[model samples]
Target: MGLLTERGELEAERLTPAGERILRAASTLFYERGIRTVGVDAIADAAEVTKKTLYDRFGSKDRLIAAYLEQRNRVWHAFLDDQLAALAPQTPADVILALFAALTDWMAESRRGCGFINASVELAAPDHPAMPVIVAQKQWMRSEFMAQAALGGFADVQELADRLLLLHEGALVCFRVAAMEYAPEVAHRAAADLLAGWPRD
Candidate 1:
């Protein structure tokens, strides 16, 4: 059977220590070095496994790239979930601004802007195996933001989501461009003001 399929590869019966090691190494290598830059040989050496073993387990470099992106998607969602959980019984302004706070905290220790964003830039090919993973992740994030906006009592949840998404992404770009740490705070305030001026439900 061809390795690339819509459902993705079957889960192995059991993962060996080496398999786990390979995943761990891939996690670091793929995030630190761009996926295109980190070849199978690099992954094998870092995991102390043979290239054949890597292929036997994952089928191909493309599959491994999908796996790596799936792993990262889970991590990014988990971070957003954690933030949402902290703000349960959500208030309008606080919940909205909390996202900004979360972004601020994330940027301070993130070391780089975002693994998914960085990887997407490197994988310019539209049909790359990792592209669906990126699109799915981003759609999920937008959904989460809309859900939060609803919880915060906004009549225009989608609009708020769009605005917040723009501001949030803008803060990341500004942070990268300006090499400044305060952009998130400013964005958060601006977001709060936008919400405040809106006609309330």
Candidate 2:
């Protein structure tokens, strides 16, 4: 079984028109209002579909949550890809720093912080259908950092990636949870300095 289907959930791409509407509504509601608080009823009301349609499309609220997160992962990657293309980083180091630079703009509109982090907090159960999606989202970031570090011939790629991920995630939390409005700027500067002083092969 596929990762999503291990729990018997429908994939996000096979949505019908009504399914699309349901997912669109769920994604907005889940992000705007916490996932735990929003119900299938609200999603159905927002999508203007019956609860049965929502179930038929997603199979369960848990599955819908997974699809919401999967959709978010795609959106985030696309945004980052656009940023990277626009930045046109000349070196691997530039690529790494560009990621930190992108974070400031990415969080400009939302005060809720990282959606994956928020979802992880709410879906504490390790076996939850959406847990893998949340974990994969984060792992992807770390892997990107590690890949860039390796490409740059930086020593200790694993450690470097870990440190970068820490700063990246910390800034996200501080921005929302601690109300550090300039948290992303702080992270960017920290990443730049870290890269500058980092050991080369």
Question: Highest TM-score among the candidates is held by which one?
Answer: 2
| TM per prediction | 0.80, 0.93
| CA shift of 55, model 2, Å | 0.3
Clashes of each: 0, 0
lDDT of 1 by residue, 175-197 (tens): 76677678888888888888787
lDDT of 2: 0.88
* Candidate 2: clashing pairs of residues: none
Query: Which candidate has the top score in lDDT?
Result: 2
TM-score, prediction 1: 0.80
Question: Which runs in model 1 stand beyond 4 Å of their true positions?
Answer: 1-15, 84-89
Candidate 1, lDDT over the whole model = 0.73
Off by over 4 Å in 2: 1-12
